[model samples]
Target: MKKSLETQTQLVSLNETLINELSSLKQVIDESNKKMADKMDITANALITSNGSLAESLTKAIANELNSQNRKMFGQMQKIENLTVESMSKLSSRVASDQTLSKVAGNQQVLAKRMDGLATQNQEILKQMEIS
Candidate 1:
């Protein structure tokens, strides 16, 4: 009879533990449900606040803005093209001048060699005169 009573006491303790765990689980579920409800309420309020339709005048205004932007971009593209053309012309002129300068430098080198040869011939003549 004492063993039977001890078994009963253990069963009661286990039942109480399960009940406490269930209560804790219920509290966690309730908090989750409250958070979901708050999020849904915020979504609903945002939907209600921004209910104004994108009507005809607003669409026309957006179209006008897009057109204005397109015109400005096209004008900028034309300016870039003009600048490229002008720069290319200047580069061509500079290249031509560089070629002419290179030719002039070659002629100067040839003239220097000729002057050195003449000076060497004059020195040989002077040495011969001094010996005679």
Candidate 2:
């Protein structure tokens, strides 16, 4: 019976040692998990900051490009407007000249009719003299 009691006490001590070792392992695992969580959080924050900066830079670049394009478009529009005005001025001059040419043609037709009448009268006079 004494031997049985000594064996029981040894078993109890062995169980206690195992429980302490398990507790220490659990504490080490918890500490490692916490450190890993902290590192992940810090990495996530850095990535977010970098993404924000990249987005801001892209937006500024796009705005700048749009502004440059708008300025170029405005300059082209002004050039087109100037060309249109010049073309209109030239067309107005051509129209004025056409009006003058129409008036001259009308006058030429009148002069031709007068010359025909004079020729007919001269021909009739010549015929009368020849008959006499």
Candidate 3:
């Protein structure tokens, strides 16, 4: 019975030592995991910051390009408007000139008829004198 008690005491002491060792190993593992977690968090934050700045730069560049294109489009529209106005003016002048030419043609036809009547009357007068 005395030997049994001593064996039990030794077993208890050994168990205590094993618990202490396991606790030390657990602490080391936890510290290593915490360091890895901290580095990962730092990397993630840096990536986020870089992405945000890149997006801002891209937005500004796109806006400037749109503004430039709009200016060019507006200039093209102005040129088209000027050309339309010029074409309308030219068409109007041609129409007015055509109307004047029509009136002059009518006047020339009436003058020709009057000249034919005068010639016929002069021929009649000459024939009557010759007969007398």
Q: For model 1, which pairs clash?
A: none
Model 1: lDDT of residue 40:
95
Q: What number of clashing residue pairs does each candidate have, in the order they appear?
A: 0, 0, 0
Predicted model with the maximum lDDT: 2
| Model 2 per-residue lDDT tens digits across residues 1-132 | 999999999999999999999999999999999999999999999999999999999999999999999999999999999999999999999999999899999998998898899889889999989999
Candidates sorted by TM-score, descending order?
Answer: 2, 3, 1
Name the regions of candidate 1 deviating beyond 4 angstroms: 1-63, 124-132
- Of the candidates numbered 1 and 2, which has the greater lDDT value? 2
Lowest lDDT 10-mer window, candidate 1? 48-57
| Model 3's TM-score against the true structure | 0.66
Error of 2 at 47 (Å): 1.7
Residue 91 of model 1, lDDT score: 92
Q: What is the C-alpha RMSD of each candidate to the true structure, in Å?
A: 17.2, 3.8, 3.4
Q: Which ten residues in a row have the lowest lDDT in candidate 3?
A: 110-119
Pairing residues by index, what is the TM-score of model 2? 0.69
Question: What is candidate 3's CA lDDT for residue 32?
Answer: 92
Question: CA shift at 84, candidate 2, in angstroms?
Answer: 1.9
